[model samples]
Target: MKLYEFERAPNPRRVRFFIAEKGIDLASIERIQIDIGGGENRAAEFRQMNPMGTVPVLELDDGTALSETMAICRYFEGNHPEPALLGQSVIEQATIEMWNRRMEFNLLLPVAMAFRHTTGHFSDRENVFPDYGSDCGQSAQRMFDFLNDHLADNDYIAGRQFSVADITAVVSIDFARVIKMRLDPDKHARLIDWHERISARPAASV
Candidate 1:
């Protein structure tokens, strides 16, 4: 198996976290670096695997390339159900997806837009222009407030058990700090505490 990854990207980090949590052997898995801003992923060679030219693509032993962070996460869940990252029951799976989607739209999307628009990280791509810097930033801040309130009662984003939803949310929250947006420790103690617990996980350092 092979993984096309980018060190500075959150999407790849999510996959790495899952692999670490699963105790998957990194030595057996080949890693190919994808230059996020250099059009390396968009090149003809890489595009044969992922038309979208995104990072964290998993190439199976059968020469199948899997894309999308959520889809890849689910694939790993199905293959390795011992840790059950996606969730064990139907309701648990649904809850995980629900929270994951919310986090992606409310937090991840905005963070990416802010980075791209403000920094012009991918200005060369015709479809990568910046138009949502202010909107994305505002929406992301609103999400922080919503998450802060929701996390007051729960230890994790989806529920009692740690699931892929927490993985997605944690990555987005951590990435937000790069844009000077984060859960205020004074204002959101519960959320801050939750993050601390998640951060302390042995897999996090991966």
Candidate 2:
């Protein structure tokens, strides 16, 4: 499988983390990096693979291109069931899915909005709304507080197990930093501790 991605992007990094946690040697998979900032992702050749023009597309050997981070992840999870990140039991799966959505909606989406609207990094492709972006930054900060409280007792995002929800939370929290969102050691003690634990994992570096 060949993963078309921009490694620095949070979405691609999420998949990389999942692959590493699954005990897969990341180097074994062929990686094709698309220069997102240079409009490479929007070009005709790339758009043919993923109409949405997003990175982190996994192309199968048979020429099937799987887009979306979670979709790509689900494919791998199905293939490699051991040390399951998406979960095995029904309840575990539902719980992980719930937490993952929460992280994406409350943290990841807001952070991306904040960056796009405030910095105009993709202004060439999309409209910039500074006021709305500022609001999104404030909204994302509330999620930081929410996670801090929720993680006070839980070892992972989906409870005691390190699942895909944990991966989402970590990536969202890290990306939030781009909008100047910081999990202060004193203010977000529990969240900070959780971040440190998650970051220490070998998969986190991937």
Candidate 3:
């Protein structure tokens, strides 16, 4: 399989993190970098592969192309279940899914929206609303407060074991830097600790 991705994009980074955590062979899957900022993804040849015109599309050898970060990660997780990032059991899977979704909606989406709207990064292709972006920044702050408190008692997002939820949380928090939203050292002590711990992992660098 070959992955069409933007090197610095958060969505693609999540996939890279998942692959690294699973101990997947990097050489086995070819990585093709797409220049998203340059509008390479909007090109006709690329759009034919994925009409959505998004990066991080996994093109299988059989000519099947899979979009969406989680779907691609789920594919590999099914193929390599050794170090289960999603989970090992049904309940664990559900819990991880719950936490991952929470991070996706509450943290990731807000940060991304804030970045896109406030920075006018895609003004050429879409509308930019400063007020909406500010609201999203505030929304991300609220989620940060929730996660900081959640991490106080729980060792991980879903509990003790590290899972995809943690990956999502870490990536979202890191991405928030672009929006000037960050965890306060005093107010978000637990989250800061968690961030440091997770960042030390080898997979986090991916």
Candidate 4:
């Protein structure tokens, strides 16, 4: 397997962390750089693999490419089920997916909008200029409060066991900090504790 990775990007870091948590010795996996600023991922050759021209694309052994960080992480879990990052039972799977979707929609998407509009990071690809910065920031903060409340009695997002939902939440929350947004530590003690625990995981640095 080959992973098209970018060192500084949080999207790719999510996938890298999943790979590490799974204990998949992909040391032999090839890594292709997709420099976002240099337009490397936008090249014609790379675009053929994924029309979106994104990083963290996983090219399987048979040469099939998987795009999207969550999709790639789920695929890895499916292929290597020992670690079981998604879930084992049907109900568990559904619940995990539910939280994962909520995290993406409520937190991750807003952070992306905030960063793109406020920082104009991808202005070249699409016009962005603080068009929705305020709304995005508000949405992120709202989601943070929601998640903080939800996680008050749980060790992880979905339940006591760790799952993909936690991965999504952690990445989204960390990414949202770019907009100076976060769950209030004073009001969200459990959420803050969860973040600290996840951050201390060795795979977190992967």
Candidate 5:
């Protein structure tokens, strides 16, 4: 398998972190670095593999390519199920999926939209809808508050155990920094504590 990725990109980092948690042998898989800022992902050759031209594409040995971080992670979890990042039971799996989707939509998407709309970083590369920037930032903050309250009682995003929900939350929280959305120590003590604990994990460094 070949993983085409860009270092420091939030989505790709999710896969790297997931792979690390699964104790996957990096040597067994080929790693291809794509220059996202340089628009290499937009090139025709790369676009052939993924029409969306997104990073963190996993190309299987059979020449099939998988896009989207969560889908790729699901594939990995299916093949390597011992660590069980998804969940063990039916209820647990459903809960993890619920929380994961919530984090992606309520937290991650808003933060990303805010950054893309407000910052000039991708102004030349993609369309910038500045009119929605404020709304997006506000939505992200609302989700942060929601998560902070939830974290007050629970250690992880889903519930008791660390799951893919936690991974999504951690990545979203860190990525939110680009839009200047952060966990206020006074307002989100529990969230901050959770973040600190997740950050200390070995997979986080990956």
Candidate 6:
């Protein structure tokens, strides 16, 4: 299998982190670098793999390509079952999925939209709407407050164990810094603690 990704990209980082957690042999999978800034993803050959022209694409040996971070992570989970990131049972899987979706929508998407719309990073390649950028940043801030409150009680985002939900949350929270949205130590002590614990994990360094 081959993974198309860009270093430092939040979405691709999610997949890299997942692969690391699963203890997958790095030698077994081929890694292809995509230069988003240089318009590499927009190229015709890359677009043929993913119409959205996005990174973190997993191309199977059969020549099938899978896009989207969570989707690619799901594929990895199914193939490498040990150290399960999703969950052991049906209920656990559902719970983890719930939290993952919540974090993706409430935190990740807003933070990304804010950066893409406000920053000059995508100005020449994509449409930039400043009005929506401001709104998205405000939305992400609200999510941070909500997550901080939730983390005050639970050690992990989904519940007791560290799951994919935690991965999604950590990546999103860290990536939000690109838009100048960050956790306030005084206001988000629990969240900060959780972040620190997760950051110390070996997979996080991947």
Candidate 3 structure, TM-score to reference? 0.97
Give the candidate number with the greatest TM-score.
2
The residue pairs that clash in candidate 2, if any, are none
Each model's lDDT comes to 0.83, 0.92, 0.92, 0.84, 0.90, 0.91
Model 1 per-residue lDDT tens digits across residues 18-113: 988887877678988898777889899999999998888999999999999877877887788879887778888788888878888878898878
Please write out the lDDT profile of model 5 over residues 82-123, one tens digit for every residue: 799999999999999999999899988888888889885778
> Which of the predicted structures, 2 or 3, would earn the higher TM-score when compared with the native?
2
Residues 1-206 of candidate 3 have per-residue lDDT tens digits of 89999978889989999999999867688999998888999999999998999989999999999999999999999999979999989999999999999999999999999999999999988899989998999999999899889987899999989999999999999988877787899899999999999999999997
Mind giving the per-residue lDDT tens digits that candidate 2 earns over 32-58? 999999999999999999999998999
Residues 97-196 of candidate 6 have per-residue lDDT tens digits of 9999999999889989999988858898888998899899999999888988998778899999999999999999889887778799989888999999
Scanning candidate 3 in windows of ten residues, the lowest lDDT window is 174-183
lDDT-wise, the better of 5 and 6 is: 6
Please count the clashing residue pairs in each candidate, in the order shown: 0, 0, 0, 0, 0, 0
Which of candidates 4 and 5 is the stronger one according to TM-score?
5
- The all-Cα superposition gives candidate 2 an RMSD in Å to the true structure of 0.8
Q: Which stretches of candidate 2 lie over 4 Å from their true place?
A: none
Scanning candidate 2 in windows of ten residues, the lowest lDDT window is 178-187
- Candidate 1 Cα errors over 4 Å, as ranges: 127-131
Ranking 2 against 4 by lDDT, winner: 2
Checking candidate 4 for backbone clashes, the offending pairs are none
* 4 or 6, greater by TM-score: 6
Clashes of 6: 0
